[model samples]
Target: MTAPRLKVFSGNSNRPLAEEICQHIGMPLGEATVTSFPDGESFVKINENVRGHDVYIIQPTCTPTNQSLMELLIMIDAAKRASAHRITAVMPFYGYARQDRKDQPRVPITAKLVANLLVAAGANRILTMDLHSQQIQGFFDIPVDHLFASPVFFKYLEQFKGDNMVVVSPDVGGMKMAAAYAGILGAQLGMVWKKRTNATTVETVNVVGDVAGKDVLLVDDITETAGTLANAAKIMRDSGALSVRAAVSHALLSPIAYERLALGHIDELITTNSVPVDTRGLPIKVLSIASLMADAIVRINNNESVTSLFKIKGF
Candidate 1:
């Protein structure tokens, strides 16, 4: 039997990234009308035929989180009702990921709720990159193909490879990610111990491992207010490090984050274009993951293994 025809569509959240993915895939984005009603309810209509076709919808739930997420769920429902053979929701940046668990009383596990919502809306599979926690995949009953942005970061970080480099995790929770980058770059590993003073504030209590006289590369899965990174960078500099930089997979830069970044604690902020980012004249470098995601989509469509994509040397 022949495979289902593949068709890709986009919601309003990240049309540019979706267009770039289609460009890399050598196909035009499937026609879809995604808009809102006067009362702000989302409306979606797949303009092209997708009956028995393999469909992929690209929409990252970034800022305006609820709206973007609703759009994705609606789009998935539309595809399901249209009789698509298989529908994969491609979320480059999964929002509500930080709320994976209920750390506080009377709080809900919003991440798990989001997963249940997606499955309920009829997503057959999920393709996302670098979730805040690896275990978010368990929230879904459907097959989840989680991709990493490390390959893209590794290629760009080749110039920084040297003996005097140290990969530092901004906090203890990210030590594993920092260790992976350290191994891949052949650098030393370090970590920061922090205490959360409030929802938007962080205090760095101590630093582990040697970073003096070394070029520090702080690695973390996400950053929003820049508090954690900025605080960590300040300590690294004060500790006599040559220079401090950060490699954050997702840069959810808010106005406060921009203000903090402008303070110049970190020399550079390297991030992926998983969401819309405005550098605002800061030393921020945004790398494209369009090609990487496009390659994964192709492999998935071909029923081939995507495990090889994670095989970075020493990682």
Candidate 2:
């Protein structure tokens, strides 16, 4: 059976990653005019005909969150109006995901709201990675291919694992991710108890597991202000950890985050280029997930199972 023609386009947020994905998949990126009007409203026009073609828009709602989100929505709407056979939003980093729940009164579940926005904009499918919470997938009625960056991390961290290594979670919220990394690396698991005094400050209260004389590797889904990672690394070192490192899926480094990491005890901050992050001479190493995303895209285009893309070698 012949497969439908596939086309991919990118928004302004992370065009490099999208282009890299297209390169790995052996396809040229689709042409589109995605710009903003003088009034700050998004304007999108598909340059080429997309009628009956399976169209995918690679737009991660990263920094300048509102602008990126609007661009994606407008592009999806444009694809629909162009009579595309299907429209998939491939978001490498989903913004506003931290607002997935309303633990307090008068708060909105913005994650679910984003999902609704994508659906309303005529997105036929979603391809995203390492959401703040996995349940965000259920927020969408469309088929969602949620890929993980663990395989990429594991592959890179293999050489760094040692005899007395311990995987630590920066906070209780990240215990699940830490456990997964620990299991894959065959290391001990630990956690740091933290209290958020403010949005920008995190106080490390205690260490939950044994880390004395062990090389510590902290894992988390994201890090913006670096408050949690910096604080946890300090406490772990004070508690007798021989070395400290962190592996975060998203490193949306702010000025505050960069300053903190520059002075913090963490020996390294390993992250993925899910968003645009520049180390600028800090102890930060970025691993590429473009290949992972490309493999998933190819499988999705073939209507084939994408489970194997998550597999790590020898584990």
Candidate 3:
């Protein structure tokens, strides 16, 4: 294989993960300055020569969403102007994915809008993991390598699999993911019927499958408020579940979510380090995806197939 002239840069969103990935790949983090003006406008400058080099910008549009997003755009433009041969947006946690569809009248598909913005900003490709929905990939016309955190999640879960295990979806929408986990672990599949009363509140009406006296594993793509997962855990415990644990790809957990986790409604909250989570004072457990992401980046740089990254038996 030919050596890939690869370069990895990062924005302010998730610098620690980027640094870890760079370390895993045995490459120094690309030099770039990402800062904002007093008026909240983003400014970016590439400190090293990147002309004709294959560049990957690691930036997750997490908290302070707009500013981070703008920073990514500016960096992409900067790389393009510096004559980079290829530019890939490496977003571990894809934000604005919830606005993928027009569910209501006058609604905007901001996910699609973000895609357009990236393309317009001179990104040649995208590398992200565990989007809110699979269809969100269609929002982009460029090449997209969508990855899963299941490999990381499954590795951690392998230690806890037993005969009394049951994999559960926090809501009906996540049933498919739950079922896959169940099949892989040889556990029962269960789902909670959840009703969204508003933007922040969710009610678990009932459970669809048998979870009685079983160790429950609740799986979801992401969680922000922790309301849905916490409520589902309470309902499952009340319904005779022995223990309840949750595993999510992206945990953009709010302060309330941290409080809930501390209160112990859920047994274990296993998640990937896709975003910057402050687990210092919480009972949440985070698994590293640096090696997985680093491998994908290397493969992409070499023009190697990335299909195997998505082939989780239960996912």
Candidate 4:
């Protein structure tokens, strides 16, 4: 039996990753024209025949987030109008994910808003990776295939696993992720309790677990200013940690992040190409998720189970 025609399209954000995904899936990039009008409005036109085909629009809402998000929405709407059998918004990096809830008064839940917008724009499903919060999955009323970058991290961290290793969380919110890593790697779990003094300043209150003479792995979903990671690394080192390395899914490191990284507080920063992070000779190691996303797209098109993408053995 012939496989149903599967088409993949991309937006201005993270085009290289989309191209890599197409290459991994052994498919040609779909024909689409995305441009902006003289008034800075996004305009999208599907150039190829997509009627009755399963279409996947890969757009990571990274930097220039609002613009990229608009492009994704428009693309999904175009696919739906063109009579695609199904449309999945393959977002490697979901923007506005940090605002998943209303912790403060009069604030908006932008994550939920994004979910509604995607569905309203005719996305039948969503394929994303390492959302800032797991509950962000529940924001969508539609079927959401939330893939993790853990497998990608495990594949790389497997080599560095041994005695005297501990996974550390830079904040209380990340204890769950750190615990998962600790359980998978058979290493100890540690947490750095932090208090935000200001927008960009963080104070490490205390270390919860032992790190004397042990290599530490700090796990986080994203790093913007990197103040938290750098402060945690300093605290870990002061507490006798042999080394402090960070494994984060999204590396949206800013200028200060690079400056802090150069301070030698963090030994290594491992991240994925979920965003265009420039290592630029810093001790940052970037892994690719193109294969992982490619496989997920293939399985979704074939109607196969994607549960095993979350399992890990020996980290």
Candidate 5:
């Protein structure tokens, strides 16, 4: 079968990651002019012809959330108008995913809203990693290829598999992810009881499971303020845990998170480079997911099954 002509372009958000992905796929990054007007308007122009091509726009809705999202939408619209055969939005880190539901009386589901925006902007499909809620995929009218960061984290964590390790969820909600980590690493499972004091604060109540004298690894989909991980680490340490570390998929570190990580309660933070993260001299190890994403892109372009990529250590 003849392969579809594939072209990949990137927005201003996390250009380094897109470049890495291009390198992994053995292709040069597509030519594009993405800039800002003096009035703060985003300007995007595809310098190369994308007519009838399977186009993928690499843009992560990272720190400057609104700008990145706007850039992606504009890029998608540009591709659609330029007569691309298929347009896929490659979002390594999806912002506004936390507002997936309405727990409050009158709140908007930004995740769904973003999904609508993507569809309206002419995205035929989406590729993202480790969403805040898995259900967010259901909101999209277009096909969403949700990728997990576990495969990348697993290889980096294999060295500590034989240690007396306990994979813990920093909060009640993250139990499922922790359980998966525990099952894959062949470690004990644990959970931390916590209450959200505020948006940026988390108060840990207690720790469950046996963590005494064992190395604790907290697992979560995302960490912005680091309150949950830091507080959980403190409680685990107080409960006689030998060491406390955290393995988070997306670490959107805020100023508060930087301060918390500097406290040293958590010995190390293992995370993926879904978004651009600055270590800032902290003990942060950012594992790259570029190769994994590149492979997935190739599979998607080839119309191949991505099931094998989802498997983790025979689990």
Candidate 6:
């Protein structure tokens, strides 16, 4: 008995990351034609046969969220129609994730809707990283391999390990994530209490833990307008912290984010290449998760557990 062949394809969302993943996996990316018509309809045509093969489509629903999402669904449907044995939607940065719940009346749970759309489009499983909320995994009935970028961040953040370091969550909601980093780095934990003034503005009110004279490292799952992070950093700086930095999983930086980042509240911003991020000459460090994702893909194909991938040395 032989294992089914594994094939990886990518949409236009994050092609560079996909190419890097294929390079790490030592396989060529499966060819596909993903384009738009003049009428603005998404079209996907798999150039290679995937019959009885294990297929994975890499498409992060970022920037042009709707278009990227539609392309992924079409690609999945094409692979399903081609008789693929299994299909996995590889979304490095799951967009619409922040809308997992309805905080207001008459608001829809777009995260759940996206999950249903993927499953309806013939996705057998999902492989994604650093979702905005863990509960989003429950939105799907299919198997979900949720990988974290912590291990990668841990390796890069090793240099900052010291008694003077304090890990802080930009908001109360990210306290859990901040605690994990603090524990692994053997540092103190802290949090910022922030109120969302609007979709793109935030007001940081209070600090939960001590940051005085400590090198503060703020952690979060995502940042769009940079409001939460910037405000948190301002409060941390005003609180007598020696320095303030940030480690975010996804940097969906917008023009406003760039403007905020330019204010120089945070010293350094470390994040992953989960989505397309342009530094625009800011103090930002982008790490690659290609090897991390490629290893998971190979393990999944071989029916092996990916538990070890999450293990960080000295943690």
TM-score of every model versus the real structure: 0.98, 0.98, 0.97, 0.97, 0.98, 0.98
Alpha carbon RMSD to native, model 5 = 1.1
Which 10 consecutive positions of candidate 6 have the poorest summed lDDT? 1-10
Give the root-mean-square deviation of each candidate in angstroms.
1.2, 0.9, 1.6, 1.3, 1.1, 0.9
Instruction: Provide the overall lDDT of each model, using Cα atoms, as 2-decimal numbers.
Output: 0.94, 0.92, 0.90, 0.93, 0.93, 0.95
What overall lDDT, based on C-alpha atoms, would model 5 receive against the true structure? Answer: 0.93
Stronger candidate by TM-score (3 vs 5): 5
**Residue 102 in candidate 4, Cα distance off native in Å:** 1.2
lDDT assessment of candidate 4: 0.93
Cα lDDT for residue 223, candidate 2: 95
- Give the TM-score comparing model 2 with the true structure, all chains together: 0.98
Better structure of 2 and 4 per TM-score: 2
Q: Select the stronger candidate by lDDT from 1 and 5.
A: 1
The sequence of per-residue lDDT tens digits that candidate 1 reaches over residues 192-259 is 99999998999999999899999999999999999999999999998989999999999999889999
lDDT of 6 by residue, 1-315 (tens): 566899999999999999999999999998999999999999889999899999999999998999999999999999999999999999999989989998999999999999999999999999999999999999999999999999999999999999999999988789899889999999999989889888999988999999989999999999999999999999999999999999999999999999999999999999999998899899999999999999999999988899999999865
Off by over 4 Å in 3: 1-4, 311-315
What clash count goes with each model?
A: 0, 0, 0, 0, 0, 0
Colliding residue pairs in candidate 4: none
Q: Between 2 and 3, whose TM-score is larger?
A: 2
Reference-based TM-score, model 3 = 0.97
Better of 4 and 6 by lDDT: 6
> Model 2: clashing residue pairs?
none
Cα RMSD for predicted model 4? 1.3
lDDT of 2 by residue, 71-163 (tens): 999999999999999999999999999999988999999999999999999999999999989999999999999999999999889987866
